[model samples]
Target: GPAATWDAVDAYFGPLVGEDDVLAAATTRARAAGLPEIQVSPAQGRLLQLLALTAGARRVLEVGTLGGYSTIWLARALPSDGALVTCEIDAAHAAVARESLAQAGLAGVVDIVLGPAADTLRRLVDEGVEPFDLVFVDADKPSNPVYLDLAVRLSRPGTLIVVDNTVRGGAVADAASTDPNVLGVREMVDRVVADPRLDATAVQTVGSKGYDGFVLARVR
Candidate 1:
């Protein structure tokens, strides 16, 4: 089974990425608090860290902060003075994430914005904050296109934008699929492809989370 194989692979290679007590604690706390276990897997979190590091990202904007698992990973990629702002609509999740981020020693570098992502993003634009070096969109899947547009608005040239859960086990290839999540991803892909200001690609991934993919775009 793919699920069993994926688990075996992760078990074998996970240690290479090394252990993370903060990440483990974040997941554990989220479970204890009865939060959804939909946070990215450890391997996926590491991939986000790698992307931020490779892009030389100093300022990051994340559209989701589920228990701060990925937030810690991304924050660790930043310099001591770098900052990250993550948006979460669920007040309970935000509360849990704040405590986890503080436990990870990232409270000084990370900011949690509570409210709908669109509203928070609009507020950021209104405040005229500096463009981010990297943006991660992992919130409501049906709003992928909107998030991508805002990611571009909040970014300068050379900024990297990563959107998770784009593939959905290859359902994106089915144009007739009526699933809002699938259609949302498809629309985002099509919009990105036709955009003149971005260069992007989609990569299918398999992990303990099963098969899915992400869109990686660089603002031009």
Candidate 2:
């Protein structure tokens, strides 16, 4: 989605609630540096925070850092001892994300693993990390199903697994769409829907992020 469209959506959604200027500046810097689109909308950020709190999430795993906008939101929901582990493939973007998270006073709560997310996740699992209270996956489109499998493995019963960009510009809705990214998303949705271990639902949303969507699932 275009930046202008995101701005327009932000405008329509009313003023951002907390540290929005910091988020916007970080997003601008990230884009100027040719980073992939990674910032979460204020509405979605708030929603993530709410979900964390509602789920009583203490140890969280985030598949993408992306200037740390969503990381800040998730970390803020944790208690004083809680922690968030976020993965980012790009060092430059990760550096910017560290700065943004520090600005939000949440740097201490987040640990950024700089590498391919799948490798990093496997390492964490191999190291015997405890089950995560929540898992947020927003990495490469083609890896959605793979990430979903990893997330489920890392979660305990009732853990929340949230996936961003499930709609893929409305491509996932059309069975005939041949776009690789869209097909990947549809396959992921179908997999999630059929998995007996998870109860899932996809919600369509429109805002500063344009007409995107997300899938929310609970490990059963």
Candidate 3:
């Protein structure tokens, strides 16, 4: 019942916040391409765009690109010369993303890097790519610790890193949970708190996406 209410509220407010036809078309394409419908909600995408705009993010890094729905939102926040790089492991998913981004007119500004994200991230580090103003990590939950560490390495003094799906339906609070994703979230929390280079906090969210949250950390 509550979840339905959340969805209704999201629908009610979506148009007030600019959830338009282009975003809906992206979802349609993703579904037609047989991609998982696990992308963030329209409200969430708008929130991301607002964050990037507020940060004046000229360069954004996204660890997941599921049909590029979120990537479209992030890329729209960038200036003409700005760039957003997103990582995807599946060729089919990347293909769908390419089409969606092309329709969104973000193909030129967004680069979809296909392959294992860990290797790609390491290459970017080795090549000393310019620091990202914002980094969004939403890939495999089990590798969150690794992603967190790498995201920090790619950051400058004021970079903001957002880790999605950290709460895992509130399972992260259970010390005895055996789920790998839960354990990964716990380990990520432990790692963040102990790292002197990071100042972090997590926010529990409930919406059409259900009970989950995200970790928001800033480089110190």
Compute each candidate's TM-score over C-alphas: 0.98, 0.90, 0.98
In order of TM-score, best first, we have: 1, 3, 2
Instruction: Work out how many backbone clashes candidate 1 has.
Output: 0
Q: Any runs in candidate 1 off by more than 4 Å, and if so which?
A: none
Question: Tens digits of per-residue lDDT for model 2 on 1-220?
Answer: 4757867766776554554676677777678777777577778988899999999999999998878878888898999999999999989989988887888788888999999999998888788899999999987888888888888889899999999998866878899988877877888888898899999888987776777899999999
lDDT of 3 by residue, 47-92 (tens): 8899899999999999999999989988999999999999999999
| Candidate 3 least-lDDT 10 residues | 11-20
Q: In candidate 1, residue 215 scores what lDDT?
A: 94
Model 2, residue 163: C-alpha shift (Å): 0.5
Q: Who wins the lDDT comparison?
A: 1
**Overall lDDT per candidate, in order of appearance:** 0.93, 0.86, 0.91
Q: lDDT at 60 for candidate 3?
A: 98
Candidate 1: C-alpha RMSD to true structure equals 0.8
- Candidate 1, 181-214: lDDT as tens digits: 9988988988899899999988899888899988
